[model samples]
Target: MADLDHSSDDTSVDSREESSQDSKLEFSEDEETLVALMYNLIGERWSLIAGRIPGRTAEEIEKYWTSRYSTVSE
Candidate 1:
């Protein structure tokens, strides 16, 4: 029989990819507000939010937040 030891790893990879795809646009007001509140409460700790919201990759949130910060700083 074939081994299925890599199943979990494959699922994780697929989830990450789906998150990346979902990050292309702005999230709804509810989601954005919730994520922002959570970010303020946790500060640079996105894995927590990621756990609650499916397809919300940490990279996308970090990038969007950084971009907003940079724009404001300029």
Candidate 2:
């Protein structure tokens, strides 16, 4: 109760760099190229690429490409 005066106003920040310990990368240049090639080769059948690339889902890949198109057009 005695130190309650400064308790609310005291600010502390813990800073630490966050590094991803992920073994798999989401989108590398090579992966992008391969995804594109797979898309063309399969034509909307993203499962082919998703199956080859670990930790990648066909739905997420499609969403990413769709978002890219929207961003580029805008």
- lDDT (0-100) at residue 36 of candidate 1? 80
Estimate every model's Cα lDDT from 0 to 1. 0.72, 0.63
Q: Which candidate is the best by TM-score?
A: 1
* RMSD to true structure for each model, in Å: 6.9, 8.1
Query: Measured by TM-score, how close is model 1 to the native structure?
Result: 0.56
How high is each candidate's TM-score? 0.56, 0.53
Candidate 2, residue 53: Cα displacement in angstroms equals 1.1
Model 1, clash count?
A: 0
Across residues 1-74, which tens digit of lDDT does each residue of candidate 2 receive? 75775564453211111222122334788778877888778877767778877778877677656654455642
lDDT of 1 by residue, 12-68 (tens): 899998886656447778778877888888988777876666778777677666665
